[model samples]
Target: MTSASLGMAHTSSQAAILDVIRAAGTISRVELTRATGLTGATISTVVRRLINEGLVLEVGRAESTGGKPRMLLQLDPTARFAIGVHLDHAGITYVVSNLGGAIVTRWRQPGAGSDSPAEVVARIVREIGGMIARTGIDRSRVLGLGVVSPGPITAAVGMVLTPPSMESWTEYPLAEALEDGVGVPVLLDNDATASAVGEYWAGGIEPTSAFAALYMGTGIGAGVLVNGTVYRGASSNSGEIGHICVDIDGPPCWCGSRGCVEILAGPAAVVTAARAAGLDVGPAERSVAESFAAVARAALRGEPTAAAILQRSARYLAVAAHTLANIMDLDLVVLTGPSFALAGSLYLPAVEDLLSTAFFARQSHPVRVTISTNASDSAAVGAAALVLQSELAPRQSGARLQAELGPEPVPAQGRTSVVGSLG
Candidate 1:
């Protein structure tokens, strides 16, 4: 092989080694060599390079088998940082994480309803700066930002096309705008995909696990994962489950469809149902999130009307889950996002019981349905994990778009130094 090809191969191996070390949390050189199936010499070389790059740190020694104690190495959480921003119609979730996907800082702010797209971009840039300052992380060590928005996204263009509920952001160049404003390569994906990636990074699911993360935010979507990689359908909107027609005669959805799961079973639908059932869901002007929370609280307190409304929604979700399970033959279904934080208990059992008893693969295998273990800020965490995944294990998340489209052009005013390219 040519020297250049060998060098490229070495770089790929190094990335793989870095991913393994990050996954292992803390591992010795021998274990790394075993995990990567690389020669001890190659492992030593890669470890030395990573150490020099400040990406890996040598911690205390591990117990020796026979000879002297073996040195333990781990990803230096301080070596690099990533920012994740989750944009919603109601609020924004921003999280800063290290290379290990640990949340060093997290913030929640007003949503797009409070500001225009341009204003939101400016706010994100300013907030990101403050987060870095507060965390005392060097600017250069910050990798890049991953922005997760409601989808039907044209992933190739980083455009957020007509999302169901976030209509004000129609056809917005959110990724480009944020990149120009922040001077960081920005990755854009749907909430479902981000939450699924978060699940992968959280390490509860196995590497080869096939599961679906059904993200319930203002709208609903699915992130399908097969063998650890999200199955981004053509146009990267694979998980728009909310638009799946669960009832042909159901209410009209903002997506211009009738009887979409979103229109029938989304938070709005649930809140509406509760209100129609004579449950005092506060004032009609209350935000959908607040109304949904009220309904969930009532349901948890055994209000029959509220419980019945959520059950109806869960039944529709079960229909969607059945279709997803059959199509993907998934082993698990994870309900994630801020909406689920309050009402997952009501959704989980209904979906789980339906799938377990009547799923397409029921006779063959049971499809487990559960809420995300990290439900508090999964989308934000997933957004940060997107950066870690793109930088250290790009292949796993299929984040090679930058190589295809080239670096995004950074605007002039308020231009900051570019972190490593991630788009």
Candidate 2:
């Protein structure tokens, strides 16, 4: 065989073995051989390589089944680290995570509201350094930095097609700028997609065949996990549930659709409805996010007016949730994001009730519904997980992100519905 082919085969085998070890939590060499369908000799060679790479470690021995006890192999969670940052209109969040996708430390800062791209990038560089320094994590140990936000990320060009939310921060080279400042590779992805990956990697969430991380903030989107990996559809942006029409004659959306979920039921829509009704959510000067949160807080406080407002929004969201559950045949639905974090209590039962009784395949398997524990920081945490996923389990259904190139200046006049994705 050719030398290149031999090297490729060797690496593939090592990746396969490591994946099995990670999935099994702690496994013996004999079990790995069985799981991988590789010979004992091949497993031993690959495992030795993984151990040498500091990716796997020997944790005590398993119970003796027959001869001598076998050494249990497990992933070395601390062998690597990744930084995640979420850039948004309301807040910028940062988190440092270990190899196993568990957060080690986290920090929060003000969002990049009306700030120039250069100014925000400078702050991000400084904070990432602070996180690394305070956590005492060696710089070499950091695999990369993952950034998630609302812009249209075209991984190939490394240029973001800025969205209307971050209006002033357009035509900037986000990936190249950050990478140059931090001296580490940077990955830029949308918040909804990142949230789904975070849900998969988070220790708090249970594994399922199909699930959706429904992220609700200024807008609404879903990150779908099918068969343990993200399902990045045709254009690499599959889960924009917000654009789906929930009402034909409700209202027109920026996407040129009438009665889309975002316009009819998103946080902005909810806040607008509340204000129109003279509910004291907040003054007009307050940000939409703040007013929406105030409404949620009041709902939680058992105010009838507030409860009715949030409940109406939840019902609209539940329509989208039910439609998603039926189409995906999902076994789990995780509500997350800034809006869901504050108002999940109102949204939960509405979604749960519909899925329980109305799901198409309820007889086969009942779907479960819950809120994301990291809802507030899901994008940031998932951004870190993207780094770990690329290094550890590179095998996925969708295409990998293309190598980034020099950034191009693009106008935000027309933003495409689809963006880059991690699949």
Candidate 3:
């Protein structure tokens, strides 16, 4: 073969080796050679380059199989870091995490409701700077920033087109403005997609399973994962479960639909219902715990009116969940986001009951519905995961901060590690 052709072949082989290492976590050179069907010489050369680039490190020696001990190689999880920001009508959450999705630093601030696009972007830039300073992580090693916001979003242009509850942020250039302020790559995605990715990375689930993430926050959205990859539909807006109409002649929704899931079960609907039932819902500035306590207290105190309002909301949410289960035919569904923290008790059982009884595949399959252990902050974590994924496996459109930050070094063979084993 020509010399140029040989060079191209070698480059492709090295990329394949990196892919294997990223999947395996910690692997010996001999094992890598066997896994990739590459020559020992090629593996050694690639490993040397990876080490020189500070991406791979020789962690320790591997078990001896009646022969010389092999040196184990691992991806330097701390070699780089990424920032995740969750933007909602309720608040703004920022998280600094390593490649493995472990949180190193986090900050939560009041919601950016009335703030203009520029004002909110400036605040976000300031908060991110503070987070980086507090963590003492090198700016060079920080990959980029990922922002998860309420949908529906125009992912192609990085804009929050029209968030149902966040009326002040119509057509906001959130991603572009943040990128300009921070001088780094920024990605904007649906909050549900971010929550789903967070659950996929942090929730110990079967790697091969198809899962659905139903996030109930200011409004409802669903994130679908099939075979370990997020499925963003044609417009990158697939998970608008809130607009799904279940009651044609019922309450009108902000989206001009009658009895949509959001109108029937979102916080606005519940709070409105509660207020109409003669209970004080409390001020808007209190902690989420206080708000949830209000709901729980009203429900547990034998106030039939308050209890009836929550039950109605829960029942509507269950209908949405059942619709999602039938459409996705998923094996697992995870409930997440701040709204679910207190309301889950009222919603979870109703969903489980409905799915067990009326799901399209009820007789042929069983659907598991569970609340996320990381409910309060799943979207923020998923935003971090978005940065990690973009760094490790950039799409054809290329890295968001390609001009500012050079390509992330490929993870070494056997460098991927899960914090805990999956069931």
Candidate 4:
């Protein structure tokens, strides 16, 4: 074969070997050949290339079945790093992580709001630079930045398409601005999508299982993982659970809906209810954290009023969970986000009870509900996972890429649908 043909063959062999190592997590050259359908000579050639590139490392010796022990090859997680940023109405969280998504360093900044796009990008770039310096990771090893913001987002071009909570951030060229500021590629995804990816990576869920992540924060969002892949709908806004109306005419939501989940059970909703009960709730945003903590403290001390408010929020959340389960036929539900840390205990039991009773698949199998282990930082970590996935396992780009680059911008529209009886 010609030199060019030989090079192409070697590249294919290297890709195959890398695929085996990623799938096995750790495996010997003999095992890699068996897993990848590559010959022993091909595996040896590819493994040397991988080691030379610092992408794979010989960790230890694996036990042999009936032959000499072989050196185990594993992905060099520390060989590269990625930065993940979670942009929320409450705060902005930054995490620098290795290829495996283990956070090496973290930083927090004020959340995105009425600030100009340039201002927000500048702050993010400053924080990222500081984090990179502190971590001492070579700039060349840095993959890119993954920014997770609340929906609706255009994942393809990385734009924030007028999320309800941050009205001033409409039609923001978020990814381009951040990339220009930081001088690196920036991937923007919905916070819920990031949370789901984070859960998949850090939460120890089986990679092939279908799971739904309900992220409760300033607003509610859901992330649907179908067979280990995030399922973004036609407009990259599949999991807009906040606008799922539980009460038809109860209260007005900023999204122009009445008695939507966001209006009924978001942090603002809980604080409003608490104040109406004469609890002296402070500012809508600041008081949310303080008020929820007070309520959690009071409830732990057996205060009925605070406990009742928490229960009410949980009940509403349970309704949404049930609705989501019915629509998606999901078996596992993960509750995550800062709001979960505040009111998880209250939300978990109520959600479990409702799912057990009213889930559409209750007769066939039990729906499992659990809080995300890294509840407060799921989105941030998932943002990191976005970078890892882009580097490791990018999806086939056909219609998805075209849709991402199309001229039609995502409309700032919200919908409310009552799935079933709330009771």
**Alpha-carbon RMSD, each predicted model:** 4.4, 6.0, 7.6, 8.7
Q: Which candidate has the top score in TM-score? A: 1
| Better by TM-score, candidate 3 or 2 | 2
lDDT by residue for model 2 (251-333), tens: 88866779998888888888898888888876777777899999998889998888998888888888888999999899889
Pairs that collide in candidate 2 are none
Candidate 4 at 67: error in angstroms?
Answer: 1.8
Highest-scoring model, lDDT:
1
Cα lDDT of model 4 overall? 0.72
Q: Write the per-residue lDDT of candidate 1 for residues 1-423, one digit (tens) a residue.
A: 222322233227776677678778899998877776777898899899888888899999998788989899998887888898988877889999888888888999887774667887888888888888888888777788888887666534444456544666776677767776776767777778889988887777765668999999878888887765668765667878889997788777777889998889999989888888888889976778888989999999998888888988988888888888888898899998877888999999888888888788778878888888777588889988877876776553354344333332121122332334322
TM-score of each: 0.90, 0.88, 0.81, 0.84
Please report how far candidate 3 places residue 212 from its true position, in Å: 1.3
Q: Is candidate 1 or candidate 4 better by lDDT?
A: 1
lDDT of each: 0.77, 0.76, 0.71, 0.72
lDDT of 3: 0.71
